[model samples]
Target: MGENLSRRSFLKGAAAGTMSVAALGALAACSPSGAASEAAAPAAAAAGEGLAETGSYDVMSQMSLLNRNMTEGAVAAATPEEFIVQKGDGALQFAPGGDPLGITPADFMQNVPAWLGEAPEITDIAGTESCDILVIGAGNAGSVAALRAQEMGKSVILAESQTYDEYDEYACDMACYNSKIFLDKGTPEVDPIDVMNEYVRKALGHVNLQIVRDYAFRSGEMLDWMMADHIPAEYTEKYAKTSNYKGNENFSGQCAGQWSWPAMTQWRDEETNINMWPFVIRSLHTSLENLGGKVAWGYQALRLIQGDDGAVTGAIFQDIDGNYQQIDAKAVIVCAGGYGGNPDMRLDLSDSMRNLAWAYGADRTDPEMIGGMGRDGSGIRMIMWAGGTMEAGPRAGMSIGKNGAPGFAFGGAWPCFGPEGKRIYNESMYKFGSNGHLDLMPDDSLLVNVTDANWETYLSYQGYGHETMDRSSDYMVEEVRQNMADYQTGPDGFPVRSFARFGKEYSNVWAADTLEELADIVGYTGEAKENFLAEVAHYNELCEAGRDTDWGCDPQCLFPIKDAPFFASFGATGGQPSNGLVMLSGVNTDGQYRCTDGAKAAIPGLYAAGNTCGNRYGIQYGTPTAGNSCGFALTTGYCAAEAAVNDLA
Candidate 1:
């Protein structure tokens, strides 16, 4: 995903910034970081070294200074990718003036919950369940942490807030590599150094680099243990459904289990919005129980107890029966999900996120919202209250993708109707397919997309009339060209089932027959209506021409509309957009997964796993590939367990 700063404006700003760069270069000669440049600027000083009167550099130049090293080629044949890099990935990455926003401690704390102000119970209460390791939050990371510690034969107590009958609000495929399963399936072992470097280059800019190094080196062994012992054989087939995204290319060794229609049809329909990770989750539950570890399903963590010597001594929890459950242990692992489910916390982080939050029971009156998956950052806050630091920018990771609403084509141009019934963005814009979602997210204040049967037919070419074909299918590939040559017939009739239950339930998708009728229903007004009709007419002309004169729709994808009985639905994202997933950020920790103090030193007896920890991501998903979220949860949980066990020893 990228910031919405248009390229035309960025260049205008860059050309101007060049002058500022020159001026700044001259000034830097006398400053600390640019002493050598001062000697180089003598030509300017002689000609009134204050050639402050040179190029057309304007105020925009100050913001566009990431490119101060550039003279030209902002978008040369070899440099178009470079432009997006300097420009930014989203609203937060770049300042309004076009300069990168400076990193701060607050940025790291954006998703971490504020410390609860409840007065501490000063007196000691005796008699609690004693264990070698105490784990909070039994999700992906917590399960792995508990299981790993149990394997070391440590007495363990794994606690979850939801009762025995309840399940996690969301689940997905796990991303990982170098497991026995991948090798058995002929998948190669991935190179740790390459993956680590890529994480540094693309995701984390100037952030610290230790935690990732720890995971990158040991993740494979963790996977080996998972496939060999942690997972029960009965669940092996379910876990075997791995999706090796990009495995055929640069990511030849990495893989994640996929979200299959069979495994997650309810998630597909948005009725249950669950993931396949629960298979492994259940297996983990069974394995941990089988290993003589106790699980407390409805234990809500309150806070950590600190010792006079500064090591974490124990924890306080609220159990389902409304009684306090104190747990004394050698080490405590906090793996509760991040703050995606917490509005106050999210609002504290970025006011912009308020609109993005899928809050609890937010209705149609607020179409931008949905019910979050309940990652309320309780563990993150407790860890911080015990003196843990949050990671600085190049900070939290955000899930970015279409929000499963009817809108623009993510890969290339199928044409999207924006606010007024006109195509929203230049079809050529998504040519940089890497961050296309940044361009496709609803741009208008309302953030809606309205399209007709032609779009439905266009999306259908690859999948079940629309959305099923697999990314691995050859038939899906050729059909796009075939459909453009001769448009496919409209699906026998409107297949209302294709729309997710949540969209229909929330009233986000609407359909009408006549163009004006459809426009009126979706709120396209007089000017917007006129522009939309004009846009459709122009689009047909472009399709006929086999060349996009207007916005440069690809020659292969320029199918035009001219049919009746049209349809429209919201949540038409390729899959549910990344926003539907948990927003990942948390308390900063050290190489051993110990929660770090403000000075970045370890806070003894406290460790974090999964989203409670940071440095596996910065700004957004660390790896371009999917599954990094689940993979990090798994590997980091394992690594944290190892460190905590050694410390206890």
Candidate 2:
């Protein structure tokens, strides 16, 4: 297959009226999920309907409809063996080792995407730079890699697409195991094996245990080294003191009963107002520059250069001014983030991730700008061109539930009703867990969140991320009320992106003194209206009895809707069925942070870290703590540098 064989290219062709239904089906044979659905007549029929009627290729709509059609009368498939593409089991599942399934990377991805075409065959380069190590991307991982290599006395060059002033930096908490900071604070040390096993369990054994082991055991030392002279333990102490923590028990096992620990460390300097990760980025840059290392800002990697023996020797980079340059290095570390910025790459991985979450910082449109943040898939593609494989779908994403009424954290705790007014989730699950169910709902139907006047009381039940009940301040409650008031006072017929044209006039937030009026305001009629009222009444009953018999919500989260002036927030308030902050998977790698070939052998001089590398979190982006990704990035960058240093020596 040449350049036109990619699924994304085919969809564009179909949308442009160059392909027919038969041609689409022929292309579907290449897709793992599409191939499985082809054997099921209902799914096939729905696929045909979706393709034939729609002017453009909306794969998620087609796929969602196809799954709904297949599950209409069929029982939920209990195992992968029973149904290759399991449906209607809350979340979608696929056969293991198959496309959209867990374990190994998809077989089809062994072939690179045709869209990349071929790298520029430029002979006359504007510049040719030589370095001992070349680290692409100056984000969290690349920055560390460059600094570590330079610190190891290697001539390092850090190539970043963005300028020095515009380097993408964000503050974040990082996960580490048994750091001195934690030890001094009396935090418990965790077993690295237990952490890896838990990750494997969640990923259904789709993880690289060795790579995770590197992160699990070595991340603390990496953190300690990075934090040296930058972040102070006193800063962490101040943060701990200000936290409104009810207890560690309340936050335990928040990700579907996954074990959680106090291993997550954040640098909060409320006193000096310095952000941790940003400061770390600046510090790394300063140290690298001070060590006589160079940072080639505004240079993007175009392709990898491999030797005759198939070892990656160097790479080609394109500057913003349409100029080309070659950088030859003993080892090239690719930590240029993940592919979340590219919609086609995300769609290629999992249609769910592509259609479900909006990518963060995805507004870059320059031809030279591959992706914003580390989300440009260029680094992964360059490695793939040099024969690196990627982790297969259904890939995990980091959906740190931002959906809710503005300024409120109780979106996941309220009673949620689907389009037919049926209760969808337990609403007590973590935001991502509950929102995942909402995303897999049968159709792109309207979903609403209903809560009583005692919305503030629900704050007590809210755990993790935005917990405020332990604090004496009523400011959060007031803020939520004010935000709701502002939403209600907005003009009618506000456009909600998720809603179709028919519901454009429906203001997303609605309020009324009575349940009936609230239902009317939300456009519920006939059976839907009755179902809404019934669900609310049943929920109130459950709340009064201090138990949720229907959805089995936590008893503590069961607040009654008996109070007057009940509120209903329309659309998906728990979590939008869109791209999360970022897609967490990437090109597959070995324990040493080397991007490996299909045989799982390290490609001699290529390494990857951060989101550019994969097999860390497994099938889903679930982690033992909030900052695992950040910690893994820092650790892998440091480790990749060490590996390169040793190999070069």
Candidate 3:
């Protein structure tokens, strides 16, 4: 039953049912007189030729029949006894009815597949190749480093994770810097001193002074480098035009009357003209190639190679096809971006910054959003593995978005929502005047209403105010009443009504009606809500008087809430999660950006730049000081290259 069938036997069996004339003739062709000679001459060859000529059996048909037989044999060979089952009590039992092997489920399982096979066994002790400088990560920083180093007559090599086309395009493709918005406007400002100070104060709680001073002082020079390199002035101007300068001025007092200077007027246009990321990368790549520098893509650096004394020497990388290569260099520059992609890394760094969400204006619904595939925190992990310490900074990450919401907006600012759609916060609260900006002081305020019933009703309202209105009176009254009824009686007992859900479940609730009632509903037991209501009434009175006394909330901007069903939503303190906008306090370095370990001076070959190198800004987020990130990236790249060349010489 298990015999391997031969092709001739199979053919004989097949032909038994369908005897052909050619086969009969082939048999008859042999004569008795020359039987020995004829039989040995070629009857089999003639029969084969006849079969071929007649096309009796095609190759496909033969293969199909063979496969069928194989499949049938495989199925017949399988038995239920071959399977091993595990009992509920965790004992391994033999499969029922006759398999003698008595194999258990435990014996059947294997370890998870190793995506990368066992580490390469190194047989040859080949010496390392020498290079003047090595640039890690072929993104903006590394590319610029290699280009500049080569220009200075140093041999440089660039290693990137993916091919150039598939490299970190997300950071480069989008206009990342805040300057892009300013460049869209006609005028941009350059107050490096104040801008730097403001940045540190707002971002870092004004703690690190020296760091902010250095960044502010160097930022202007960084911009100048970009211009000298033939990055279009128009691009800078466009960014200035669309820049959020006014908003920054309103939020921070340090920028009062500080307008875009002529040199800083680079961001006053509306087109994607001077974005230095793409321009710099392409140009630097070409320059490095021309200068005899080699670029290797699709390679990932797994670990840093160190010396006996613990001085960094080089690195080991795994190439695209699983080949390992050790790159020897006098210096290595780590330019990989921050940990925005890795949620675990984010949690490790700061628990509050754990939400995985897109930045504002990012299209989460779009399949092609940058950084969508999430390989973000490799750089941080790699450095940690290399024995580097992370600096103390703001724990910053994006907020949790309303589940199933169309898009995500930053926290801190209150979003407007009405019965129908989404809305913006109070516009007047964002205005900046000549002397100072109008800051909304809502930390201790509360919404007050008239009756307990009305208060309960207001707390459960689904509708929000209009974008411009900031307070939707009608929607507030109706929704609050509905909510109160539902809370007192069960949903089944409450009157039936229909309203489109606004935002996520968390944001669906609203509060307002008469001021006192609104206060009770918001759970303000003390005079806190009452006092705030009194202040509101007084403010309304000031509006009637056409002037404000306690605080200068313009009467024109003030709207009276004396009407029936008056309500107020409690305002809270704080802004969106920090994104490390302004750089401040980083590893100390010379003009070459080489980091010192604080025990001695900096290591001869090492260089640092961008946010990693630090000492740029202090602590402010979203300063109208646009183009700072790019400037730092370019300046550090150039400085690192110069240092490398000098060291080689």
Query: Candidates' TM-scores?
Result: 0.60, 0.66, 0.47
lDDT per model vs. reference: 0.56, 0.65, 0.42
The list of candidate 3 runs beyond 4 A from truth reads 1-129, 172-189, 204-214, 230-280, 351-375, 398-592, 596-604, 614-622, 626-632, 639-649
lDDT per residue for candidate 2 within 384-450, as digits (tens), equals: 8888888766675665222432212323347778888877777665433324554444444767777
Give one digit per residue, the lDDT tens place, for model 3 in 1-649: 1245333343454456554666445434431222222222222322233133554422222211222233343433244444322122233222111111222223322222122113334434233465768787766556767877777777888888887777544332211222333334433544566555545645545333443454555544534554446355554443432222233222222212222222122221112233344433455576678779988788776766667765667667777877777788877776655555543344444322322223334343332232212335444444444444444544432222211111111111121221111121232232111001111222232222122222322222211111011121233335434553443221122222222112212122323445555555545556565555665566557657865454454333334445554433333222323223222233445445665544436654566655455444432223233344445555566566666677667
- lDDT against true structure, model 2: 0.65
Query: Which candidate tops lDDT?
Result: 2
Which residues of candidate 2, in runs, are more than 4 Å off? 1-112, 170-194, 218-220, 230-256, 261-280, 320-322, 347-374, 396-412, 431-436, 440-444, 452-530, 540-547, 554-568, 572-578
**Ranking of all predicted structures according to lDDT, beginning with the best and ending with the worst:** 2, 1, 3
In angstroms, give how far residue 55 of model 1 lies from its true place. 46
| Candidate 3 to truth, TM | 0.47
lDDT at 54 for candidate 1?
A: 47
Clashing pairs counted in every model = 19, 8, 68
- Highest TM-score among the candidates is held by which one? 2
lDDT of 1 by residue, 443-515 (tens): 3423234445565345432211112222322322344334333422222222222122222222223556666
